[model samples]
Target: MSNRNIQLAVLDMAGTTVADGGLVLRAFDIAATAAGIETEGPERDRARRYVLDTMGQSKIAVFRALLGDEDRAQQGNLAFEAAYDALIDEVGVTPIPGAAQAIDALRTAGVKVTLTTGFSRGTQDRLLNALGWNDIADLTLAPSQAGRGRPYPDMVLTALLRLRIDAVDQVAVLGDTTSDIGSGLAAGARIVAGTLTGAHDKDQLRAAGATHVLPSVGEFAELILASRI
Candidate 1:
């Protein structure tokens, strides 16, 4: 025990846990294709950049930013989920090395674990079942269930409330995107950790207010046991 006094770890899906193999971007492309949106021009490139920039944000938010309307954004979100589901069906869920083990180790330490993601409930459930992780986490939340997603602190706040953990400082929020860092910081978590295995680079994570940066989510247990993260 490193005496970190942490009680819970709020994790992100996709790049943070599941091995992000450009599948998300490809899914976005598929959705765009389904929606018959711009694909081969400066406009498409800019949208893709925005998607990367806003990783860990609500899919609806990303689509709204990219598509610029509620109806169109909702359509894009549905299409994205459909395409991502298809991808998962074809290839299956691939966990990041040590992600499941890390979660189990944290649970063994008596730390409650919750997963918070921008992915909707259906998609989240699909991934969880594929990983056989449906029973691993103490809580599973999606933006559609929570008020908002990452970079807003809503997900973290919801977890704290639902878990009945009064002290924000007793929690660790870990992910691989700036939105994750921002949300953790906003929620006043003691450890806002960013892993390099995902979307944002170290500099971007730092710029977004990550208190600690690790090589991957796998190192979280070690870092925490060392009183680092």
Candidate 2:
């Protein structure tokens, strides 16, 4: 098919597009510590594991899983938000290598780009604005807008709707986690997995049903270009 036939490209935020480098985890640590949960050595490891295992899940869902109860989770979430907001300035967040160029190329080729993230709208906007990406994305869909979260395909479907794309074959979902791959597969979109991002390795991504496992966003862009050719 021609490049013009591709209508949309749905991208995941955290690991797929931006390299936050454990900024979210650090926020969780601050929140957990504020909640009187000590995070030292093994405990810290466990907390990190929890974050990694649920990388693509909604922020609320991740909080609930870590805090163990809805009430506690709410409290922790508040702390996390405060800590994240405060540290966001100091936190090193850069677009993943080749991400900007790839996105530009795609847009120049008439591909609509939609970003689906598990972050709250407030947080997502903050990050985008801070990174000078406020106008770079065609549409930004958040988990808060979805009734259900990752592993459920709600956000991905929402992005598709925003893009006004009916056929899943004309869209590609690119992400770096099992949840991401699962959501894309569930939505019947072509899945391009990124390994240099999220916690998932190539085998894990493939196991989750990724159509293509690429080393980085740049490689994925090359694949997309080749497909058009």
Candidate 3:
């Protein structure tokens, strides 16, 4: 049983639990080029850097920042989704080692787990379908289900509400990026953990307000179950 008061675990999908093998960046290049970001140059380079920097944010939101115009942003988002889905079909997605077992352990410990992502609902579903994770968690959320995505606290808050969590203090959130940390912090979750399996480093996660940093999602169950907090 868990020693911590954490009742809900809001986990990020990609990088944190799912390993896409750099498919995100690969898909971004294809979509950006199609959306007129240029095949290669300073503009493409800057946009690519932005995508890296903003890992864990909603895809549409990222495209909005990159493309500026709403129409262009929507187009780019669609293109990104298409490209990402195609890649998934071509190469498939895999779970980070021990991720599924970790989640099962958490659930067995009486913690409600909700998988979350900045990807669109369709893409999120595709990932779940690809991994055969359709019933893996108590719930799964995408940015569309919530009003906003990471760095805004919407998805985390939505999970808390939908899961009937007593309070933000009773929640533990984990992910592999600073944006994930930021969302958890903003939602007032007591434990906001950053894992090293994805983008960003320890310093970056801490700077973004992570409460703890773990090596990967495989270690998250122990941190929560053994918690004395």
Candidate topping TM-score: 3
Q: Lowest-lDDT window of 10 residues in candidate 1?
A: 220-229
Number of the top candidate by lDDT?
Answer: 3
Question: What are the TM-scores, per candidate, against the unseen true structure?
Answer: 0.95, 0.90, 0.97
Looking at model 3, report the run of 10 residues with the lowest lDDT sum. Answer: 1-10
Query: Model 3, range 59-152, lDDT digits (tens) per residue?
Result: 9999999998999898889999999999999998999999999999999998999999999999999999999999999999999999999998
Order by TM-score, highest first: 3, 1, 2
Q: What lDDT, from 0 to 1, does candidate 2 have?
A: 0.78
Give the whole-model CA lDDT for all candidates, comma-separated: 0.87, 0.78, 0.92
Q: Write the per-residue lDDT of candidate 2 for residues 1-229, one digit (tens) a residue.
A: 4233557788888888888687887888888887667768777678778888777878788878776888888888788878777777776578888888888888887778888777778888878887899888789888888777787878777877777776777778888888888888888776455555776888888888888888777776667666773
- Candidate 3's displacement at residue 11, Å, is 0.4
List ranges where model 2 is wrong by over 4 Å. Answer: 1-4, 41-45
In Å, residue 181's CA in model 1 sits off its true spot by: 0.6
Better of 1 and 2 by lDDT: 1
